[model samples]
Target chain A: MTTAQLLGQDPGWLIAVKAVMVFAICVLSTLMAVWTERRVLAKMQLRTGPNRVGPAGLLQSLSDGVKLALKEDIIPAAADKVVFIIAPIIATAMCFMSFAVIPMTGVVNLFGRKTALQLTDLPVGVLYILAVTSIGVYGVVLAGWSSGSTYPLLGGLRSSAQVISYEVAMGLSLVAVFIYAGSMSTADIVGSQHQHLWNAIVLFPSFVIYVISMVGETNRAPFDLAEAEGELVGGFHTEYSSLKFALFFLAEYVNIIAVSALASTLFLGGWHALPGLGFTEQWLGGWFTLIWFFAKVNFFFFIFMWLRGSLPRLRYDQFMKFGWKVLIPVSLIWILIVASLRVLQQEGAPRSAILAFAAGVVIIVMAISSLVERNKEKVRSADLPEGEAPNFPVPSLPNVQSINVSGGK
Target chain B: MLTIQTPEAVMFWFLAPLAVISAIGMLLVKKAVHSALLLAWVMITLAIFYIAQDALFLGIVQIVVYTGAVMMLFLFILMLVGVDASDSLTETIRGLRPIAITAALGFGGLLVSLIGRATLGREAAGLVDANSEGNVQALAKLLFSTYVWPFEVVSALLITAALGAMVLAHHQRSVPRATQREQAIARFRGASLGSAAGLPNPGVFARHNAVDVPALLPDGSAAPNSISATLKARGDMLESTQFELSEVDNTVTEEK
Candidate 1:
């Protein structure tokens, strides 16, 4: 389909076709996420990760789902039965709903008809994703709460805090994107990235913030505080077993794909052919965008798996401190800078003058701040006792113990 | 606008039974928190009923603001105190005496009310927003233009509710003053300094016999269930922590 037709041409069945394609994308990507996570994690520990399931465990996630479903289902006697059931349902369903707004390609011709590749693009699609994702945390929160167990409750609270902290940073990161595109809708944002370069080049700081935030958003490693087994065993889904547990697992990977895809679509030229690139011609457009999206998504998936294998899980307090103190403040300042520059650019401020002014302001602020900080540090050191530890909470669980019985279930 | 006449219509059909059932459930639930939750659910279904009558904006806001945010405030308070079904105060009326009488009266009253007000023009007058389409943007414009004063007043209402909630949730040290804490610390420091003379300090007593107790249960031991029973008998409430049985269970027969 020509770009003109693509902009405005979905009659009836085209909508259905696009919806089917999105459904397929979610299912396929979720499978790959499972395989990618396991294989990489196994390699990190010098062990095989489901090499027996399919060729190098290609169908590993599917096989695991089948096995999990067939296993004996157990509900903890103490669990809140209805809430426990509803938690996973809410999580998985909300996760699936995100794909509805995720634009895989611009617009594709479906057998003599043209429509947007996404299922349904709302005017506030980005906010819609944000809304659904925020609500998704309730699934984890209630899962932990309704489990009526100590570990799960702690896990749930940790997850909720983790998601909240990072989501704030994530929202801050997207402010730049919204400023550039002038809309929060995913499709419109993608269309804005139609030129040779995407927001990743123009708004690299925002891009970096978004990358960090998405990792935290999906509960990926180094930030997976909620499901830290060495701390809170199995985290929120500790009590869930069999098929119910599988649903949570499925939701996590699908969310990973969705989050990564969002980062790709927003930052990378989503479906738009690269400058001097041959793959974006009209004949190859629909299929090519699909490939382009997957390539960027897989690149992120690799990073996620690599981090999981490479880094140790952050301490809960440190994890929280990083999100709130470091990520949030930095991203907020970056967004302000971006907005200021954008405002100047719109008002016809010369690029060099704006850059020079921004740099000079940064240096002056840094120098003055450094001098003030030194003075405060000197005073703080003088006031503090020689070797006394600063007062803080005693991190002691009132009546808790860890027990791990070794068995292959 | 279509009226149905079917076999199940009188007993249970469409929104009627759901509305009645949820309303009943809201009143009868044992936990105050769950009753509020049930009340929220009833309001949600009624909102859906409004949507069916084309009041879309009202339906959405009812769920979004009321169910999502306000119900959370109620749940948050419930969680802070950990009140549940077991702590609920039961009523005097039993054996369906009150419920049966209320249901009979309600049924008769509702039937009479429905028969008397079945005409369409009565609802036509009662229907809100006869002048405009009630979509979100339109409603927002109407709110800002026609109801601008009330709109600003609503912000005041929200702020007032927030402050009230904060005041209620806060717990102060009723036993001792803030100055007493500093005084206790100062007395301890003074006592440490003057080791040459053994002196009983009167200022030390001002801290109110504050026992510096270490962690009650050491690691790897089950919490003593006996203490919980002791607390129960003494009319002290449990903290609703994750399962720590008290030490009073073994002493129960002895105490009796």
Candidate 2:
């Protein structure tokens, strides 16, 4: 049976159990993700990270959570109290909601009742994920605006614009996946990749775009201009304190995990064993698929940390420009190509002809892109004379006399 | 008779009143942000209704488009325009209020009558068969086949709208923008060259690095200009004398 049908047949008690399981997994993964990010980042920067809490600081996040909860909660006098309280709740809840449709395992036996390890898989499952995430931005925006502070307000506005722009690119990137999988339901998309090649390998461009867009969407480093510390202080959650601040932190990590899981579900093949290791999926009565699923998720999460550790945050204008001028347009063009390819395949085109057609499209796209780049370079060079710096203000250094260390007699 | 499953029926009943009340609150709210939030809530309810009716594709699209994108843009604009900027109740346009009330009533009556008539005329045909293949697939089939022309036209309309926005937002510089060198020259040529080296860094040398501390000038007096005006206004600045060294007597009168 299809995963959705299997999920539908689940009893009420079983559904509740599965719900709790999904929640537990999300929370646990978030804790692990935090520890992993810190440890990984610390190692990258040549520092010891969080080794005092538990074994290798395994329980550090838990301790941090307790500390955050116990700290004094201060409500800024200028803040709109109601929205301030609601914002983090909204953020945290929405992140959890996105996990409802993500399949973590194949059909598994629970108390002698068979069920798929997922919540309800709506016909518009991927769209639902996108919708919830889009709503998730509201939390940040409201938090910033309600704070009644300049930095928070600016942060909120930046986040809104950033999320909105990247969301378009993110949505368009998924179109290619939808076209190839012929479904929007996460389960069906995963099933489509069962024995076939993963969508990441098949639709490589879409995978690349999706990966980029997800980072931007989740407000992770390099694309995390919303809460840029040097610029907007703490960004949207600047006014939040104690548990409220922790809630936003939780929401951020949860969002990262959500997008990672989604990337795995869409591109890496959710719950499916790696290529040539399909037999392992049946190990431990098929429960081992959960491990495979999380392994893929961690792979994406590692990429997030790697980015945070290596790349500097992008300037706001440059980030927005890339999103609008580069990612969105490229994804749009890629969608067109994918749709046309799907049509050609439907019409029973010969493999060689299809391959040649794809190659021609790629070449043309590359040629056009290169031409645009060259034109841009020419314009830039034309704007300035050789050996002359672009006109910008730079203060001249004062002439300093060399200090005599020895007393001259 | 319309048939809704028990769970859906419960959800509809619970959310319907909240939706209507929020819609009313959206109109009555004084704060633009609050109004936007109320409207978002209403839109979410509508999405839930669509989903309950098994129009999953429509429901999700409604959310992603209306609540997520459109309402967000609305809120963004409202925030930019000043969230506290409310319309004056004093009508500048004479008779505008009366005209608006009449129009609203007429529109409300028309919608109520239309929906009532439509619902009373037939039994609700659930989406079971239509969604047998899958709601998204079924919708896609109709959209790509039967409604293709309208879809294309709508897309064209959207593209035109985007282009129009770009055109509207495009501003031509009345004068060429000053280069950095020009700006620097203009700055240096102005009343005083005191600021040519840029504002002094805040805080007294070696003693404190806090932004609230005023820097010590060459004569050992506090430079108020060194500290942020905001900090000064907030009465958070520290006295520079506290960090300055006390004077010492260097006379040889200690010969006794």
Candidate 3:
């Protein structure tokens, strides 16, 4: 029933097989996400996407990938070739590695053998995911440095700093989930939420923080200033073309899916039996779990694509300020509140009492912040002349370019 | 105790060949950038050797920090301050240097073999369990437990190195950063490419578009404007020299 049970039950070779499958799924899913994004966006805007390719343009991604591979591989004359080449490889590899532990559709029939859908689920699976995803920043940083071109270099640098900043918020946001689940193993976390109540419902604030941070982590829409086409031209992969470019794109979408799947598992109860579906031990118990798991995952994936269409891209500076000043602080406070609730629960306090205490704490904190802001504003109003420009850091070029290209005026 | 059997034998699996190739590559590369790149490869392969020795944390730190960060700094400095291979071309220094480098290469190979013999020659694959021994969890536990002092020292070393880099970058050298460049184009942010200064009016540079120079800096040279010299050095200086062809007709045309 727990993640450890799922992981330990399998022969190690099944894990190896699942790992390979996860890698394939990520690569294939990314291709699909790309094609779907284009097609769906086209339908929204009354433009044709790649209709003439394979059936329903499903195979267009395949053709594009092939063409990209066959294209001329041009290492920039002013670039660091070894680093440039290795950057995308590392990015793509790390992306593949993240899904190795993800429960796709838990437990599937593999040549008559039943096992957990995950590759290798450890007790510290949550920390493992964090550690693995952190490596993604290396690709961005290396891509920028290796290119030796100013813009790509800047884009890489921005994305790395941006990712590291958001990861803190993201990591903090995860703390409450860990506390609620009482285990870091993702499968265990899901199993702990078996009372028909998801962590997303129990820890709504933490869930919100995690969702925002997840979008930022994957360098998705609004948070995708690193590759803002208008400003960066191509961002980190500006100089990269052919197969190398495809790899970067593949890594982005794959990482997006992996992160989304993780979100589903942590907050939405991974691979749990949906109320509508009949539960049966007649089927391979583990494989049945995978089916339920993918349902939640697919829904989240659609949300990712939907958000891409619905929202406009975010400004760079605004994104950073939100992550560092807003998200981090909010998550930290939420974590403290969650910890207090856990302590109260251990001490035999009623759930209602704990909830009331949390609400009171939130209100008091809000009142204090507002009071401080008002005092600061009054002091500033007394000192400054009318129409005087507020001093701010000389906005970095990519930050400026994002605004300028989007016709921000 | 985790015993290493025939440590000398294990080191030879990679270290023997790695040491030879890196030493030869470093000395053979004429360009400073090329040599530095070669040296990074050497450091990386050496780290791989470390990984084989069951030091996962060291391997990752070597890759993430040294190859990723430190070597990057080395390359960036090499580009930001362009090097002249011509400086290494003094006839008097060259004759003696070849012998010196050749001797150094031989000596290096001998040292690698001796080290390999001393350490890995004794290490048998039979000794290593090789099963998840140096994984992140295992490595973390090891660092926090018995190896805590060395682990703490490593962090201090990293901080010191970072501060030292900052200081070095800020220090004023005899040559200004921009001046040493063959064609330094600074503060000219016209377009995203920022290659406009490097690019001629197209018509002036070549007739048939036979060359991609000035408009393109050669690989490894950050100075886009200095690309003409790079191309000339490569003996691919476009189709024709602008001085003779005069494709621009003196006044420049705005290219699309």
Clashing residue pairs, candidate 2?
none
Listed models, DockQ each: 0.05, 0.35, 0.04
In terms of docking quality, how is candidate 2 classified? Answer: acceptable
Deviation (Å) of B83 in candidate 3: 12
Instruction: Indicate the DockQ of the complex predicted as candidate 3.
Output: 0.04
* Top-down TM-score ranking: 2, 1, 3
TM-score of 2: 0.86
For all candidates in order, the CA lDDT equals 0.71, 0.88, 0.72
Encode model 1's per-residue lDDT on A1-409: one tens digit a residue. Answer: 4333454457566777776777777887788778878888898889988888778879877887789999998888888787789889878887888888777765566676556577765555676677667667767877887787889878877787787678888888998898898766687788888743699998898899899989888888988888998988899999999988988998998898888888888898666666666456355636667777788888888888998889988877777878889889888888778788878989999989899969976898699789989998885565322332222222233333332232332
Candidate 3 chain A least-lDDT 10 residues: A384-393
Better of 1 and 2 by lDDT: 2
Q: Can you give the TM-score per candidate against the true fold?
A: 0.66, 0.86, 0.62
lDDT of 3 by residue, A73-122 (tens): 99988887777898899888888877766666555577567666678676
Instruction: Name the weakest run of 10 consecutive residues (lDDT summed) in model 2 chain A.
Output: A388-397
TM-score of chain A of each: 0.85, 0.93, 0.86
Candidates in order: C-alpha RMSD to true structure? 13.4, 5.3, 12.8
Residue by residue across B88-129, what tens digits does model 1's lDDT show?
355556666678889999999999888778763466443445
Q: Give candidate 2 regions above 4 Å deviation.
A: A373-409, B92-125, B145-161, B174-199, B202-256
